[model samples]
Target chain A: MNLKSPREQEYIQQLSIDCVIFGYEDEQLKVLIPKLDFTGDFWALPAGFIQQEEDIDEAARRILAERTGLADIYLEQFRVFGTAKRSNKTFMERLVALNPTKLDDWGLDLNTLGWLTRRFVSIGYYALVDIHKVNLQKGNIDASIQWYPIRELPSLIMDHEEMIHIALDTLRLNLDQKLIAYNLLPETFTIKEVQELYEAIYERPFARNNFQKKILDQQVLERLEKKFTGAANKAPYVYRWKRY
Target chain B: MNLKSPREQEYIQQLSIDCVIFGYEDEQLKVLIPKLDFTGDFWALPAGFIQQEEDIDEAARRILAERTGLADIYLEQFRVFGTAKRSNKTFMERLVALNPTKLDDWGLDLNTLGWLTRRFVSIGYYALVDIHKVNLQKGNIDASIQWYPIRELPSLIMDHEEMIHIALDTLRLNLDQKLIAYNLLPETFTIKEVQELYEAIYERPFARNNFQKKILDQQVLERLEKKFTGAANKAPYVYRWKRY
Candidate 1:
């Protein structure tokens, strides 16, 4: 898409939105990232410009849906990144070099190029989604879309790494409030699975007995039937989130 | 204060920042608001435009300092308000009617006025300050600056009421983490004072024994000398925040 089109000029120029979509799968935390179409080595969080007529939250939800193909998920605004030099000139120059022909075909003038390369203050939003439910699609500006382990994320473009850091901090803070975790877990999950998820996100091992007691104390989980492994002497009980 | 001047055009036009400075005094939660200079009945959170060369957080701090005449306070970015028609036509007409001569003196043409009255996306930042510490000052664009009890706030302009609501929610969420409250309290305080502060902010009574036990369990407070009441049989102990 030509971001510098005359029609696009009606939108706010110096503001944008970026979403950090967190998903849990295979006993690990993951984040969705898009490979920029032009820069082969550059990855970015699913992000887009805010339309002139939409609310900021609406813009974030629209971007998240467009990229992840999921709606009605748990989404939140975490932080705003507005450093004066966030759009680093070196990164812009590299991007331009990688897509000179594409830029020329877009009919973008020097003024438009300068405008595109200028600093932007982007609002960061984070979404918690069930990994198996996502229908990811590569957009026009992205060569490919994939989920990477949160702890081992590839080098991302601009300040997305910092954005993810802030998002994770926000998630951690909200963890104690019992507002998350359900979004990352399956409808039916073993207590061990729940403990592992917390350990993965918190990057610490919790004592099994203590963790179970603490989580059960919240009174938001419903104990369900035991999962039988045939060979096991005693099957462990599973639980599901009780709707409040 | 002529926003239409050539020098003022160097700043970003579409994005602005507003600060909700919360103060606690006389056992009441208060917020500082400025009476708009032009519109008689209009009150607003201290707000200003973002300079192109500065970071958004820096802009917020500058605005906070400019109005409160204090620095090194606790400030946080809470939310971004970006509705399309945030600048209501009625408010604009009222402002223009109140300041027709001032507008003309600033050489503001109709196009400039229209641009000024167009949609804007503002980042909301909240500051927590000790009421005794702030050197409040009224700016050129404000008829007066005053602190009103949070619950008894006057009608505010634009979406400031919503912003204040979000800020209070943020503060409440952080209260449990024990990361705030110190900003609103004095350096030394009695347990009763601390409980009263919490009660005032939450607008609910907390059981004395349970509140004391919970706060002491955090292990961040150091017991000081007893605070004597003239007719007290046993004086209550004072506590100060321990520097970690």
Candidate 2:
């Protein structure tokens, strides 16, 4: 089959980017995943191909911004998923075979279908956002994207579930840096709020005193004004992540 | 100029692996780098192409073993360097032009010279090993690999110095987990030895009491038999990384 296709010509054929947008709300951790409507709720991380001259991290940020209109995201390049046969030939090619009209609409022909079967070295970047803050309006983004509680992730497509798990593990491992980097929390948050964030991330409870002592000892947070709840004597102090 | 080359057919073309071997000695941190004889002082990290059927991590381990001959070193995939023009085409092409006889020795032609200029998304893995323990023998490995102190590195080719810097930053950020994963230390070590390792890594001095408290708080180490100096009270307790 001929390799030339004007539609795919603008992209770097061998490289792709996937952005895993993670969210935390109500003491539970979540991830933003898209469900492809044509494939009956087939889910995957929002992915995009890179332009010829673009940097990989810039491509990731572009993809993330296209999917979610949120800006000022701090994206971490977590891992490169580079298995030689990572693309599922049957899933993609069969979809094309089953729906020839869809193929035409997508500007893909029998020859350009090679794009589906060829290898891609995907660079994965993950960003953290507050779940309550994310109000995704799926206007221009073609797929239905939603935040799924990580533990209750629906069936995902083509090793995406594995990617989510790895992203979460990376998120947990580098929680302090990530949380500070993204400013995911309020500027001044109570120790209880910090503890809730930890509980959600770790999916376990921590002893209040030990967790508080550990956070304080890290010296990353500076004590600020007492939390104004109108309880004068019993008010707890709110702190901000010290900017350095 | 046709694409067929029996010499270059076995490997994955789009992906390659570069291993950064770090060493700590005498309160200094060093990196293992190789100098290419063809391009004078053309230093690159020891890199190898991954085979089509090999797993990425397995490929990294294989590359590390082949270069270092050390089997048990733990390799960490730190980052993926994926700029489109990452390959230095003029340098490589000029070298080929200048030395046609050398090209014949390496079994390369114009077609396979495309191999030198093609876009590659390189997966980077960094490993830590004791400087004293690494005795590199240049038997099968083609290049002369040597350890240079992180600060004193010579001119490196094609963004390699940047790679080395990122690898060192990653090494410092993930020091505890990395130190435990590789078993780069002796089976047992003293607090002073641990302090020296930290100083080498951080390139700064840490107060004895604070450093000891921080290490102990991590609780990854288990106290073992005391150093048999026969001084009794003064001899420090040696410890091993606790097996979980």
Candidate 3:
């Protein structure tokens, strides 16, 4: 076999971006994942390929808008997974097993498949959007969309679980700056709900008085005059994020 | 061309790791960069290629030792840069200009050139090492080594300057943890030195009294016996990290 010239190699393959969109509500951590039209019943993170003209960051933002129908929320790049095995033979094997003739069976081109499975150096960005802000959509196939609590996350397509773990670790470490206050609760919530959110994350209950001191000290919440409906005592004053 | 078999098409190229080793000395933040011995003039960060059996993290540790003879220091993966132009045509152009047929002239394997210029996905780990702990070595052919204060870094070889910037940003954001402190000062130092180090990073002097109160309250530092540095004025008391 004649050796391919360096220029002919053309082996620098396509790149894609994967997003692990995180949200918190009802004291449960959640990730916004979607179902693909092509892969019947299979769920995957809302990911998309980078266009030649787009920066990776922009590609992620565009993907978020196209898939979620919500925009202008804050997102942060946490990690980039670039190992050669990122999209290894296992991915192709799984695809082939689903349908041996699926290359043409699905609308996916062979070149597209190669590009899709190319040594994808994925940039993982985790977005903290208010759960209510998410107007989820099924990507070309599924019947309905919903937020799956992270603990019950489905078998993700690739190393997505690892990506979520990384994002959560980053959030936990930077909780003071990137407060869970905005991302995890309802727009208008009672103090009990706020305490529940922290308790869920800390995996234990915090002293009510101490937690109140810490939260109030941040000056990120505004106490409302009205109380939540049907509460037991004094209807604990409702607190809203300073700028939901 | 007939499609290359997947096994044959999958090229396991070389992997290399580089560390943006940072230190603080004399109220300035510095990085340990190498003055290349090959060119005998150009400067670059200390880097070495990964050996076949080593993990990427191990490769970083090995490279650190080869360049600085430093071991068992804290190293954290801050980012990975895999830009198509990280090793742009400039390197090849320089090499080709230096010797029209150097591969043949020096009996070097020309195959190495393809790999050298091809895409490299480098894992960057930033290390905090006490400037005193490093024993610099002329580890590779034609390599000279020196420390460059980050603010005045010389022209670097590739995306290394960007790597340093990201590392510094990571350090700055994690100041509350004081994770980067142990790497900056001696095993024992005065509160003044600690304040000076932070000032160097902050790029402005902090109120001495306030700085002391804030830092000491963190409980990560333990005061030690007075240092007799032979300097005047009531030798300021020394302190060391408690290694919690």
Which candidate leads in DockQ? Answer: 1
- lDDT per residue for candidate 2 within A1-244, as digits (tens), equals 1122334666766567777888776667788887664544557778877776777777777777766777667688888887767774656665565656765775657675566466666778888765556657453323577878878998877778888888888888898754442245756778998898888878899999999998998888888865456665676787888887
Model 1 docking grade: medium
In model 1, how large is the Cα lDDT of residue B20? Answer: 91
Per-prediction TM-score? 0.90, 0.81, 0.69
Q: Taking the tens digit of each residue's C-alpha lDDT, what string does model 2 give over B71-153?
A: 77867889999776776476677656665676677576656667747666688898877566666844242457777888899
lDDT of candidate 1 over A145-228, digit per residue (tens): 999998889998888899999999899988878558999987988789999999988989999999999989988889986656
lDDT (CA) per prediction? 0.83, 0.72, 0.67
Q: Which portions of model 1 miss their true places by more than 4 Å? A: A1-7, A98-102, A105-111, A222-238, B1-8, B98-102, B105-111, B224-235
RMSD of each: 3.4, 4.9, 7.7
How would the docking of model 3 be graded?
incorrect
Angstrom error of the Cα, residue A84, model 3: value is 8.7
Error of 1 at B222 (Å): 3.5
Quote the lDDT for B45 in model 1: 87
**Is 1 or 2 the stronger prediction by DockQ?**
1
